[model samples]
Target chain A: MDAKETVMNVLKDITGTDLSDKMDENLFETGLIDSMATVELLLNLQDELGIDVPISEFDRQEWDTPNKIINKVESM
Target chain B: MVNIQPYGTPEYFALIILFLLPIIIGLFNGRRFVNYETLFSLVFLVLTFGGSKWQQGVALIGYVIFEVITVGVYARYRAKQNNTAPFVWAVIIAIIPLVIVKVTPAIEGGKQSLIGFLGISYLTFKSVQMIMEMRDGSIKEFHPLAFIRFILFFPTISSGPIDRYRRFHKDYVQIPDKDRYLKMVDKAVFYIFQGFLYKFVLGYLFGKLLLPIVAHQAMLQRSAFFHTGLSLPLLGYMYTYSMYLFFDFAGYSLFAVAISYLMGIETPMNFNKPFASHNIKDFWNRWHMTLSFWFRDFIFMRFTFFIMKHRWIKNRIRVSQLAYLVNFLVMGFWHGVTWFYIVYGLFHAAAMIINDIWLRFKKKHKGIPHNRFTEGFAIFLTFNVICFSFLIFSGFLNTLWFK
Candidate 1:
């Protein structure tokens, strides 16, 4: 699967909610994900997309939305 | 020459408000009174660390200088290149003072470290956070003066809802528009008065008046039930200590955050109805939130990544469980090097592990009741567990067990 697809799948699996439509919404603010889920998403992204982002590098502004997370993953 | 500790009494608040008057007026007229802010910081620092505390004042100055140099050097090195060893050394060096401060009391039989000052831990957290963020390339610039302002931000210098460096810098450099500033002032007033109720009234009643009464009874009735397991007075001691700890710390946090607001920095909050939590994980998200978030981000996630990268922890569930244990253990040790504190940490670790297990099981068993009654029961259980843990954390366990 593509990076965007993988990100969506990870978000869905961890949050137990579908966020495919809310691509531009703030995941943290919307209560769709939290710190624990964020870690889980990072691990899943690393495993699936070969994108290794440290928790230290995780900023809410930089990757608060699905599209931003996808962009970050692809850039990495 | 008048010296007063931060938030130690009502008079301290009055003095701080008087000092903040000019800065507040300056902000209203669209000027930041930066010099006055710096002066207030120095004056408060003197109040906290001056007079009988002059030795601590010296230590704070020396510690600040050392951290500034260390962080400045680390940031320069990181800007040029990314290396693991130097980053590790920088973090170790930054934390060395705190480690010494924490350890000295244990080794010296409770004689406080001479080099220790109030809020050293909070300051160290700020500095070390900068170093870590710098290494990650998130904090690209390291201005020395800005760094000093961030560390010595006096409102939270003593106890913190430990604010983020970048977030604080953003607020510090900008003067909020009048409407926004007015709203902040309103909230600040509410928080300060609410803090008065929490700290002075409820905290005094619970901690000073009731805690001693119950604690004394617990000691007198120490041999009432099986001579070490459980007694009525011990149970009373647990509830009283739990309430005292919450009101005292939460009240202090309100005062800190409220003062930060008055200064135009939105310091993060430390509590959010923690007793209403239905589980250990939820409880952490509510109680001493900044400290817990710090541990989660810095310690737990990092350890999980380290173990995974090395393939040391192949099972994901086991990896998290182990990480939780390590995280709480360090937090426990940070509180003190005592057996009770260590046990308190272990208790939470174990509780969280069980909580995670239950959550997973409940997820599978969808037919299990998930309603208000069950939720209330869960909250009640979590509350008692937390109270028992605070009893352990209160150091009363040491008196009960060893003394």
Candidate 2:
């Protein structure tokens, strides 16, 4: 699977909500995840997808949605 | 004495109503009359600071001048260049007064600091936040008058539902339409009544009446010990102190917010059914929300960034765990440099860490039924844990431990 799919799967597992069609929707804005869950998703991305996102660069506006998370991760 | 402390009694409400009536009438007629609002703010500020507590008044003036200059100078410097060293120094100097205030009592056998004033912590929160936002280029302009108005906004100066600089500025400059102003009036009236019920009635019952009774009883039985060395009346004191703490602080917060709404500023709410929290992390989000958010934004987020940028730790979990410890430890120290307060902070830090572990465990073990009963049980557990922490925070333990 691609990094995006991997990150999405991990997010779904972390938040226990499906986001297949809501890829572009903001995770926090849409209430799909919270701060703790955000930390979990970061760790999951690092462990499962080998994308070690520095928390410093993780602005909610920029990496808010699944697609945004995927884009940021793939770029890294 | 003709001096009055702000919101100290119901009598003060009459004066507030008398002064604000004109401003309200002007707003309804589509005129803001900023001068009236400014004048009333100064008058109320004087009432709060100009009484027997005039020393605090001097400290407040000196403190505001220092912060205004520090933030103004820093913003100007940031506008010219982006350098870490000077920004760091500016931030440190801004916080020096508060640090002295917090530390002095601990070291000097509980004597208050000379520079200490009421609401120093809240104002410091606002100032430090402004400096950080300026460094981030979020606060682009720093007008001296607007900055002063933002910091000295009277309703919340004593305690806060701490408003943001930009948010306060926007609200300050705009004249809410008649319809919106009326709606604000409705909410303001309701919140003021609620504040009376919360602060005057329930807060009096719990804090003024029952807390002292239970506390006295608890002091008498400090000798009893269980296997964990816990005592009986101490248990009673736990629930009593927790209720008193909530009612008193929540009442003050309600009054503050209600008055802000009266003045047409949408100051945020501080408590939202915090006892209903299912976990320690959720509790923090609900309780003293603005203060916690301030800490989260300034201390937790910045510490996380600093840690990650320096690569001080390789493991993300360890990095966050350490951040939580440092964040809460500073918060505890800020409350006062005492053992119980420090332990209270450490307890919450540990509770949140354990809560994370439990969440991870729950995620792995699907059989651990995700149902109402479990959720209710979680809430129950969290409530008691928090109450016990409040018991420690009440300094009854200090009476039991050392006295």
Each prediction's Cα lDDT score?
Answer: 0.88, 0.84
lDDT of 1 at B386: 99
Worst 10 residues of 1 chain A by lDDT: A28-37
lDDT of 1 by residue, A10-51 (tens): 888887768878889998765566565677788788888877
Per DockQ, the best of the predicted structures is: 1
Candidate 2: tens digits of C-alpha lDDT, residues A11-31:
878677788988888777555
DockQ versus reference, model 1: 0.46
Q: How far in Å is the alpha carbon of B289 misplaced in model 1?
A: 0.7
* Tens digit of per-residue lDDT, candidate 1, span B55-77: 99999999999999999999989
TM-score of each: 0.94, 0.89
Measured over all alpha carbons after superposition, the RMSD of each candidate to the real structure, in angstroms, is 2.4, 4.0
Q: How many clashing pairs in candidate 1?
A: 0
Residue lDDT tens for model 2, B72-107: 999889999989998899999999999999999889
Minimal lDDT window, size 10, model 1 chain B: B221-230
TM-score of chain A of each: 0.92, 0.89
| DockQ by candidate, in order | 0.46, 0.16
